[model samples]
Target chain A: MQDLLYFVQQLINGLTIGSTYALIAIGYTMVYGIIGMINFAHGEIYMIGAYTALIAITGLTALGIVWLPLILVVALLCAMIVSSSMGWAVERVAYRPVRGKHRLIPLISAIGMSIFLQNYVHLAQGSRNIGFPALIEGGFRFGAEDSFQTSITYMQITIFATTLVCMTILSLFISRSRIGRACRAVSQDLGMANLLGIDTNRIISATFVIGAALAAVAGLLLGMYYGSIDPLFGFIAGLKAFTAAVLGGIGSIPGAMLGGLILGVAESMTSGYLSGEYKDVVSFGLLILILLFKPTGLLGKPEVEKI
Target chain B: MSTPVKKLVTAIATSIAVMGAGHATAEIKIGIAGPMTGPVAQYGDMQFSGARMAIERINADGGVMGEELVGVEYDDVCDPKQAVTIANTMVNDGVRFVVGHLCSSSTQPASDIYEDEGILMVTPASTSPEITERGYELVFRTIGLDSMQGPVAANYLISQDPESVAVIHDKQQYGEGIATAVRDTLEEGGVEVAMFEGITAGAKDFSSLVTKLRQADVDYVYYGGYHPELGLILRQARQAELDTIFMGPEGVGNKDINTIAGEAAEGLLVTLPPSFDEKEENQELVQAFEEKGEDPSGPFVLTSYTAVQLIADGIEAAESTDPFEVAEALREGTFQTPIGTVEYDSKGDMESFEFVVYEWHSDGSKTPVN
Candidate 1:
């Protein structure tokens, strides 16, 4: 009975972490969906978002801005703006030059951008982990001495809710907005979209900006949730989010969400059921298995390659 | 008359050259090896800082044996392979006294090179018992061995009267060795050993282990690992609502743990060296840290500062700039430090002091407890 409760708890923890992964994975999937290239620097964009939020909060606190909600709003906005701009700049400077050269070339360039951005942050931040203020204190406990209990803190709930809202907004934009249609058209066939009078460049840049903005939101929440931020934080998170994107079926919006949640839950469950040390190993191992068995992911549709 | 003039000139030139050689002999060089980058950089930084502080303080007070001390900082990256490279570099640089090689795996290999090079190495924080027990004469440590620390933790748990204890390790030398030591000691004390297991390091999930612990109805869990894994464990455990008290060695005494675990880290107990900052005798040093706008409670700030002093004291006692002479004096000498009176045994390990338990406060400070 106790073992069952422990397993259930582990499952919940996995889901919580999976939800965060899902949030970041969505950005990766959406950008990949539209551009047919993995935004390797997307993780650093998330890092910058975290740093931006950190600076904003520190600045506000320094100015004696005691209102918590207002500080969060300002920080979130700042993170999104900075990350979006970074995405736009990366597209212009790195990706644009290598556009249409070869898929591998752009991918390599993205990797280079990733390293550059990581080192840039490292040098700027002195390679130290900076602490963020806790948005919530204490936890809600549900059980007595003999009872199995789980506590839901505000930050965990906020992370879950924020991801949901961001995904909803993204879905609405992709399905309803004019730019969204253009993004989808480009994803399906960039040449066709261009031939049909769509501004391919503008659509591509917008997709990056939007994806980066969402990533920034995830970064901010992560920093707040973990109460620490580091330059290298993006690397692992980025890798995990990428895994989540792939797991959910890369290029499928809902697939990314499902993948993220699954990855998080899987990780949490692994940590709880096994030793915390094998959590990453278990998740990544699962990813490899899924890829071998289902190349397109659980939710992703198999793409028909053009002859 | 010509022969006399030539002899006088040659004598004068030879004397000047001899004096220059004498001047060179007036300085001693020691190697400070540890991770100056990567996740464990803080340890290396502290070692460097402590060595620097001691060097400055010693120099300001007219240096050791009336000669100045110079330190060469090397990055080991906490890897044994890198440690070997660093050890080779230090030996090539003629640095006979070394202060570090932070992790056990790194220190174990580096010590071999140091021993082979006839260099005297004193680790400020490496606590694996095998470190000194290997019977290497040139190697030493200022901190208590895992033998001492493991028993301390085990005793603490026994005192708490927990019905059962779960022991887990990161499977690394340091983690596994200490975990085994603790397990053996606890079992000898008639404590029930609920589970003994090994886990991979740098893993992100701990749910299965938590479930196992919950199922076993273990009253306490003692993890033999560093902060990263510990942080995730605390967070995930809390998420799974396993509310058992988690304990570990000094490896958990990192500010990063608090950040990574967030609120879940609160009330976590860890065993570490006694509070060096809270020592009334360290008031002046504490004041110095405050002057620099640095927190004295940081993991190795005090230890690092003290390492420098130890070198200075060794140099002073030797009354010579020769590495062999200074090392000899170090082995024979004792010095008061912010941490406490530090005296190395024949093998270079600290002669005294026991590990003390501390509880991690929410504000990222550790308070020493009985």
Candidate 2:
């Protein structure tokens, strides 16, 4: 019974972290869907978002905004603005210049941009982990007097709710809005969308913008949850998010979400029941296993073979 | 023009010969080796600052053994392979004494090369006992070893009388070595180690570990890692409301922990060597560092400072510039330094190194607990 409670508790912990991974993976999936190239610098954009929130929170606190909720909101807004600008700048500078080149060329440029951005942040911010002020603190505890107690913090709730609302709004916007339709059209048939008077360039930029905004949200939530961040944070996080995208089916939105949750739960359960040393092994192993059997992620549709 | 050029060349050659002769009799080079650049560079920088200050004072006071002491710096970058390359380069470059290779992993490997090549090494920060236990005569340290520190930390935790404890390490040499020591001592002291585990050093998410720690109902979390991981664990555990007293080794003794953990860093306990800044007699030294905008409170600054002091004192006592002779002087003699009277046993480990537990305050300063 104690072990069962621990497992259930780990499931919640997994879901919380998975939700953050899903948020970043969405950006990877969306950018990949439209451009057919991986935006490797997307993780750096998330890192920038974290720094943005850190600076904003620090500045706001100096301005006497001690209220936790207000500081969080302001920091979140600042991160979105800064991160969206970074996303737009990266696409315009790195991707747009290499559009007509080979597919691998743009991917290489993305990786270069990722490295450049990481060092840029490292120089601007000192190489120490900046402690973020805790926005959401205590949590609800569960279990009876005889059983072992488990907890889910309010910060975890905030992370889950924010990711859910953003994903929902984003899914709805993609399905119902004209811009979303144009984005879908470009993903499906770029030339057809262009012929239909859709500005493909603008739509592509919009995809990056939307993806970056969501990633900014993820960065802010992660900073608040972890209470510390570093510039080099992008590499490992980006790798994991990329794995989450691949596991959910590259370029699939719901698949990214499913993959992230599965990855998170696998890690939490492994650390909880087995040894914590195998957390990464468990998550990555699950990814390889899923790709082996499903070929497309759990929710990802099989790609149609071209003639 | 040819006749004048010949004269100029001859004059330059004459001065060079004179300077070479002066150099032969006037100076000795000690390499301050560590990661001068990389993620752990701040630690290297602290070591650099301490050693540099010691050299300035030593050189200012006429020379050690009547010859000026010169410090040559080498960047090992905390990689054992890089450390090996640096070690070989130092020996090749005529550096007979070294004061670094700060990380235990780097120190342990480089000690072998230093021993093989007959170069003397005195590490200021590396504390894994295995570095000395390897029984290299040329290798020595001014800081307390994990063997002493782990049991010191364990005794402190046992004094708290927690029902159970969780022992975690970052799986790195220094972290795990110290943590295992604590675990061994705790078990020997009749305390329960509810859980013992390892976590990846730089893993950003620790909610999973937090959950397990909570489920285990451990009242004390004794971690063996640096500030970054400890900071995250404190914040995450606080978020989970699984409030347990979090303690770590000297690696967690840094201002970084406060910044990384925010207000949750308050009251964090760590076992560290007695801070030099807290020494009443070292007030002037601490003030000198503060006046220069360098913090003197870092874990290794005093010890690193003391390493150079040991070198200078050894030269004076041995009355010889020979590396082997100076190493013998260090192992045999006691010398007064900033960290107090230092003496090394036959194994070149500190003879009676003392450690104390400190509590980190929210003001970003830590005070040794009474």
Which residue pairs in model 2 clash with each other?
Answer: none
Candidate 1 residue-wise lDDT, A88-120, digit = tens: 999999999988888999999999999999989
Off by over 4 Å in 2: A1-4, A67-69, A100-103, A145-147, A191-197, B1-27, B35-42, B65-67, B72-96, B112-119, B278-284, B290-293, B316-322, B366-370
- All candidates: TM-score: 0.83, 0.90
Query: Highest DockQ: which candidate?
Result: 2
Real contacts retained, model 2: 0.75
Kindly report, for each predicted structure in the order presented, the TM-score of its chain A compared with the true chain A.
0.96, 0.97
On a 0 to 100 scale, what is the lDDT of residue A99 in model 2?
A: 91
The per-prediction tally of clashing pairs is 25, 0
Best by lDDT: 2
Writing each residue's lDDT as its tens digit, candidate 1 over B135-249 gives 7777767778888899999999999888889999999889998899989988998889988888776554454666566667788899997887788778757755678898999
- Point out the worst 10-residue segment of candidate 2 chain A by lDDT: A144-153
